[model samples]
Target chain A: MNSTDSLIDQLAQDGAAPRPASLPRFVAPLALAMAICAIGIALVLEAPFIGMAINGPGPMLVKWGFSIALLLLSGFALWFIGRPGKATGATMATLAVPFILLAALLGADLAIGQRAFPGETWQRCLAAMAVMSPIAFGGAILAARWLAPTNLHRAGLVAGMFGGAAAMTAYSPHCPEHGMAYVAVFYCLPILTMAALGWLLGPRLLRW
Target chain B: MGKQTDFSGDTLDQLMASARAGDSAAYRRFLSEAAQRIRAMLARKIGADSELEDVVQECLIAIHAKRHTLDPGRPVAPWMYAIANYKLIDHWRRRGRSPIEFDDAADMAVAADTLASTDIETLLEKLPRAQADAIRMTHIEGLSNREAGERIGVGVSAMKLRVHRGMAQLKKIAEKDRI
Candidate 1:
């Protein structure tokens, strides 16, 4: 046999299995969960004062619960996408639906309450969104590279991160009650942290 | 003998698995076996005018660096070809050629035209090691004079002179051969 054929034979015998099928089922859920939790964590950290106003026992608890759920979802999705076969488009769309719904709900609420959103509040939200945008996209792309067999997953992650982050910011300027602190705490930190975590864990978790 | 042939396939598979696990010896063996094919491909693509050995080595290093991206279950031929193609394109770009339009056939023809006859190879063998390397890198490897100089730890002007002198000597030998 030719040397090239021999090299190919060697590659085939090295236990590189075709990517698993359950990838999208895992990835979509994980991405959604991560987004939700990151936003929740930022809200709690920035709005500790809200706890006293509400006469709550602990305001941070709500934020922590959301954050944990987000993280769990992201992790689970990542694990799922790291499996063997190609993930279906329907599976990805299923994951994206909730994000669109949530964005719409929040956007509508903010639009109706625009009178409350001041210039300073809008600025902070815009800044936070800007920072989060690249991080979210970078994280998604890195995750896709790590987990999915095809480069398409990486592209999706990058697109989703930027798209979702941009959408959140675009809607944020309309909400008067949603201060700059809220945007900084909710949107920015989560994406940055997720990006960092994804970078650290990618090689280990997403190995073929 | 039939059993032995089946065992050879199993042995190859085991070697690949071991290489994936970072076994250096398996990787070396794989390279040794693949070198001829790589050389053949390079020779066909760039022709005997250039230093086929340098291209072969560069291709090996690239395959090593990008090996992680290769799907172990898939055929390695395409991946190898892709890397080799990329390296050749890079070679062209470094030499200020617009690599986009340059095809394998054109590259081979250019390489063939630039190569000295076999007699020159004998004369090259007689030069100082560094001088010979500079000549080969500039003429045979198709590296720019600056690149050849950098590679041989000499200045560009010095490298140019070396190549000039080498070519002159080669011409003298060719004349002697004619006589």
Candidate 2:
């Protein structure tokens, strides 16, 4: 037997039993990380505690729907890009849904010509995202480090987007801003920035 | 890792599923079968290139490292080939040529006046006769620079210079053709 044959023998001897790298493996950790961030923000930041009860379910549901959709879609995209031979184009295109929904919401708001602007707690919203995005992103990176992602930049972008979405979801309860325009700009800005950060970091962190 | 264990009845999917479940004997059999399939596939694509074995090893390693990604319910052939194809692409990229096209180019060069392209003949004609003769004798005729120089009654360094100039001129001509 040649070196390759022996190498195969060694691999079998080592018994690389499968602990499957499924999407759920990363999701649980990411969800936990976001939950921790949300609680921390609530205790320290001292923002408005209004949830579906105070704001009514309509706006709160919309906010939760957008962020949660993004969270799940981006999580799926992240998992897709990390695997070799998986086509990420479809998953990536699917990510645009939430963004388009947000845009449509903002457009409708504008057509009605309400005097909507950033709410009093806009700083708190940005602050909450600024804190949460990186923590969520870090959790994702740790989980993805072992998956052997072939395309580092796309993986990173999805990871960052996943972080941004999680942060958005966690912060939604405390945020008083209901303007679609405000949510679109401030919420998306940190997510995009996190994506850029991930893009830059992916090559370095995800290199296997 | 047992001696001569029989696995002829099991399909690759069955073997892989067994491997995933911590059956080392099944894993060994699966890898050996995978190695043969990948070797045959690569031979068809790249012919008898030196990197063939290396690429097979790479595919095997990738399969081992990413075994968890495979769904046990699915057929194993597509997943195996996908990894094999990626390794082949990586091998070709590392070598800086599509091996099939490169092999064809080698064959055409060896064919010389009888089978050479008119485009190549025309390109060679554009060079000075001495430089063109040096390039053809060394490159196409499979002669060393010294042997080619001896045939043309020139020194080895002089022959080398002629071949170098001829190649540079050919590259310039080819680039111009693109424009």
- lDDT top scorer: 2
| TM-score per candidate | 0.38, 0.68
Listed per model, the TM-scores of chain A against the true chain A are 0.45, 0.89
**TM-score (C-alpha, index-matched) for candidate 1:** 0.38
Per-residue lDDT of candidate 1, residues A1-208 (tens digit): 7444455445434433323443463356336534653574366336433534533433233323333334344444444343323344544344444344445545665666643334345455455545555544444544554443322333344334433343343333233334323433455454444444545544443332
**Model 1 per-residue lDDT tens digits across residues B17-39:** 45666675675566655566677
The per-model lDDT (C-alpha) reads: 0.48, 0.75
Tell me the spans in candidate 2 whose CA falls farther than 4 Å from its real position. Answer: A20-24, A51-55, B1-11, B21-23, B40-52, B84-179
TM-score of chain B of each: 0.48, 0.50
Q: lDDT tens digits, residues A54-167, model 2?
A: 567777788889999998898778766666666778988998999899889889988888755876878878888899899999878866765657677888888889889889
What is candidate 2's CA lDDT for residue A21? 49
Model 1 lDDT at residue B88: 57
Query: Which 10 successive residues of model 1 chain B have the least lDDT summed?
Result: B98-107
